[model samples]
Target chain A: MLKEVTAATFENEVLQSDKPVLVDFNADWCGPCQMLKPTLDKLAEELDNVKVVSVNIDNEDEIAYKYNVSSIPCLVMFEGGAEVRRSVGLKPRPELIKFING
Target chain B: MYDIIIIGAGPAGMTAAIYARRASKSVLVLEALTYGGQIINTPDIENYPVAAHISGFEFATKVYEQAEALGAEFVFEKAVGITDSGTCKKVKTTENEYECKAVIIATGSANRKLGIEGEDGLVGRGVSYCATCDGAFYRGKTVAVAGGGNTALEDALYLADLAEKVYIVHRRDSFRGDETTVNTLKQRSNVEFVYNSNVTKLIADKRLTAIEVTDKLTGETREIPVDGLFVAIGRVPENRGFAQLITLDDAGYISAGEDCLTNVPGIFAAGDGRTKDVRQLVTAASDGAVAATAAVRFVASLE
Candidate 1:
């Protein structure tokens, strides 16, 4: 299951996580963001080493600002609290898996 | 190996799959993003034959269902590269590689972005390309659309119903859209036309607040306060991934004739990805049908 994280719990839930966290910075109004939800859900179920978390840019503006999330459906891969890789727009399931694994 | 591998799931790709399946060929469609391509962003589609007045989402869904029910297997995967094998073609995606006897390129296009300042920074905040997806968020607020084509006119008309005020800012004085659609948008009381102007800058700190538009005739600059800015300028072909495999035009569209046959044998291009005069729904469907038929003929020759 994809975990929905807020600005308050982001530090502990994502930054201090043991596994690499794939953070999806998104909003309800964004069409591509909504489209990426099913892919993220599938990733969350398939991957055990990575944690998939969703951050609503509208609700967690501070987190979005901190991460420099300019676009919706922006996927930021965080390892040891540092952003390792980032991609924007909607990607397919295989691409998302490759991004998380890499 | 599969008989055919289609590299998109839009109207063109799906239609191609439908035709290929009817030909008794094992077909696979790989879509990088969501299906429906650019049409999904459109709220209403009246031009498509038989569907007099239908929502784009509903139309796309019905077509997808039809293709799926016809035994066209679909995989959500972005094709990274294509290699020319002796008898078959190798399609390398982000996940796995698939060898197919024939390949159909129908990856469609994406909305072109205004490369002005603050435009990239305000994508989700206030800047949007799909009015149908983002129009409801700006309800009761003011918004501006940039372009002169049918998309810009349609966006203005769509936003006018939701936004308090909708401004159609085009670089040219005259719109290039249909006269009927232009007249319909003009009749809307909430719609305003800002002709002969260009959006030079987007003013925003964290989120978008206003846009700087410069008048072409007068050279006078003015700021329009808007809650959201919908960009419907145009589209760019999504053919970057297949550039190494096939010949593309200067504008990045695959150089294919009416037959949708690319420079490479056993490979075909279709839909908006190919060089064409008209890029409409009907034209794309026609290309799909033609391309699939050509692919079937190519596969039979290999046998």
Candidate 2:
């Protein structure tokens, strides 16, 4: 299972992590976000050098605002405490894997 | 190898699976996105027969479960191309290839874009296609929704409850949706209807702040400052990938009749992407049933 980030642990677990972090900004009621959960779960198991986590934008509004996320199912890739890439909406697993690996 | 392979998982495709599996035919469904197609973006389906006020997601989940329970397999992968070998057809995807005796194409339509200036670059910045997913960010802010159809009307209604102000821009003078919904939207105190205008430009530096719309009849241009822009301007056929192998009309929809028979013998087309006059959710389910019935007959005659 991908780690669910809280405001308390977000800084040490994400911003200061040794590996690149893939953050999923999502909410409970979003349909596309639910559709994408299984894919992210499988991806969290496959990648060795990347850390995957989910942030409930409904609960963690501050983190979502800081990341400038305006949409559900938003994926942001962070490397060295800086955002490297970001994409909005639902994407197939292959496209998502490419988004992270690239 | 499967007896039949359906290329979508929406109302049309899932309904097709329901019919095909009832005929005791082995079936596989391939979908690029999650099931439910464009209808998933809809909040609720108002006119479905026998189902009283069902949300789009609930209806989709029920249909998907029914199909799954009856032994139809579903995979979350896009069918890229089809290779026909008379009796047997091969479907290629980004992940793997599969073999089937018959194929049903129920691929639905994608969201129709405004294609305005700077619209492509503003997707994450301030422009969005789904109002329910992104509307929370624009709370207490001003937003605009483009189009005059049912989806546009619904988007405006959803936004009006959240945003401090909502503007609905349409090229036509009146909405094409139901009269009841139009009346309901007009009742909202913060909602403003901008009729006979088309959104032509997006004004943004890093994120969207304003939009420019041109009056279709008068040629007058007006700028509206908005925190977010939602697009719900109907849909276009998603048949470009199958254009080389199937016959298509001038408008890029698959040229299939009510019987769902395409130019190819073993290939059938169904749903909104097919050449049909009435593109409704019920009509898509009707197409699915017709296409699957035809596919079952074709596969039986093959042996």
Candidate 3:
């Protein structure tokens, strides 16, 4: 099941995960965000060892602002509550896994 | 070892090379064709900020020279595939193979063709695709635009400023374009919206003379006398080579992270090939810079 994450639960769902958590911060109005969703979901299913969650930045502006997310559909990967990798805009799963493993 | 290997020598790839080289990373750019990508085919580019009006070749030359001056090394080769074998990624070309710590894919998109008769034959002579680049050429001339989408409508509106008459031809009676564009075109005396019509053939011997448009409803064929024909149907991402290595959307565009990272680690895609809402050159360049920076950090992490 795809876990829906908000700013309120971002800390609990992603920041505290034992495995590397990939957060897809997105919004509905963003066209690129919509295009990147299916890929992210597939990646989450394929890479079960890595925790994948999504956060709607539109619903949670504070978290987006805290992360300095000026653009929607930003991906921030956290390991042990620290941001190990962060990227903005649309990206492929191979590159995301590279960041996680690099 | 090079920090990033950027594929395609387009605006995005060049801009990424500039940034990546500036960031103290050794950058290698691989190009299948000549540098500049699709922008080379454009006749004139006006929207590129500083330059008011410049030919496509001139603008591309400036970028090419700038990237070269910045210590970026360019290699001419066609990239076939990439393999991520846990140690280092291997980029395969027809002639040779290259290994790099990280990769940045800046391959741009290609315009979708209408596939009508004479469309391919009269490509440069009297037929054109990009309005921003080809509009000024038809100053006070008559031109016909095919398709009713936003890109087509926008091209019609832009052509209205330069052409004596602009015809907006569509297959359907109703257009999917915005209300503002439709309203503006309707208000313009020079612009005419031709509904339920499709171009059966582009008629031109040496140059574009006219187009054979057939009324879909009435089944009547009529020839519209025009000097130029601009096709603004749509575009398709040219991501065939790496589709198997990375995830692609239904439209064959690379699925990228917000930062332009692909499904594989240390391999990122940017610009028109990657799924983006906007495919403008400025946005493509921005994506390139972002992907390069991310690649830099990723390469650093390899150690």
Candidate 4:
């Protein structure tokens, strides 16, 4: 499981974080999001350069809307309080790692 | 080194793991993502014999657990390439490479997309390929599904209960899916069928607002206001990485027969990635059994 972030803590937890954060924009009903949970957990446990967190679109529609997140399991990498890259759908681990590292 | 290395953890690959492990050959299944492949997005599976009325996720979990209980090691890694050395084969991945006596390539297919303008850009905003995964976001909104296959029909049917209205657009007059399912859709009050048409353009600003559909017979076009567009056209096999090592058809599917034998010896292809007429869950399982059995024989002959 990933650290859940809401509209209240989005700034300090993600934008102002010291290290790069991989934010997973997801929802409870999205099957792909649930399917990606284990992989995200693995990444959280293994990787050191980045922190993995998730925001449920259902609870924080404002944040989801602000980021133009229309898809579930959307991965956005944040650095220096700015969005660096975003991947829309479920992808292979190597590709996800590349999206975060590259 | 292992006796068999299976690329992919979909039904075919997992089933191959089960069979190979049962035969007492050390087995390993490498999956790029989680297990279940495209089947995970499925809501319910009714067509598979004996296992009636089970969700796709449950079925996948059952198979995965069975393989794991049978002592098949699973590694979540993306396989990049394969090297065949007659008796010993190497499976290269994004993380590590492992040696195996035989290999089974069962990487399944992915959802096909409609290459219209704004289609790729608006994914999640209003355009979605998977209804089961993304349909909940469009509750009480008007949506359109494009395709005449079972997948499209099923997506439209599934969305009819949630969305305010559903428009099922197909290029052909008749559907290639089961007639019973078509009739079921006909009985729905919120479902409408648009035949002989194709979705040519997506009308959007920040999100999807409508779609431009063209009549194939008349060349006339109409823009339909829809909150979402669900594309269930079909699927294309994921075999680009192995096109150089093995044989692939024009559509990029591994060239293989029902026996699952690839062009290279001691390496086999199974599941939706392989070139075959049928690509059902049962057939993929059958291919796994056949491929594993053949792989066991090949390894035995080498010894």
Q: Which sequence of candidate numbers ranks them by lDDT, best first?
A: 2, 4, 1, 3
CAPRI quality band, candidate 1: incorrect
The C-alpha stretches of model 1 lying farther than 4 A from their native spots are: A1-37, A40-91, A94-102, B43-55, B58-62, B65-71, B186-189, B217-220
Q: Which residue pairs come into collision in candidate 1?
A: none
In terms of lDDT, model 4 sits at 0.89
Q: What is the TM-score of each candidate against the true structure?
A: 0.76, 0.89, 0.65, 0.83
Model 4 spans with C-alpha error above 4 angstroms: A5-23, A42-52, A57-69, A76-85, A92-94, A97-102, B44-55, B58-62, B65-71, B83-85, B94-98, B187-189, B249-251, B276-278
Q: Considering summed lDDT, which 10 consecutive residues are worst modelled in model 4 chain B?
A: B36-45
Native-to-model Cα distance after best TM-score fit, residue A66 in candidate 1, in Å: 18
Give the Å shift of residue B263 in candidate 1: 2.8
The clash number for model 3 is 24
> Best candidate, lDDT-wise?
2
True contacts kept of each: 0.30, 0.52, 0.00, 0.52
Q: What shift in Å separates residue A10 of candidate 3 from its native position after superposition?
A: 73
Docking class of 4: acceptable
**Per-residue alpha-carbon lDDT of candidate 2 for residues B137-165, written as tens digits (9 for 90 to 100):** 98999999998888899889989999999
Q: What is the TM-score of chain A alone in each candidate?
A: 0.96, 0.97, 0.88, 0.97
| Candidate 2 CAPRI category | medium
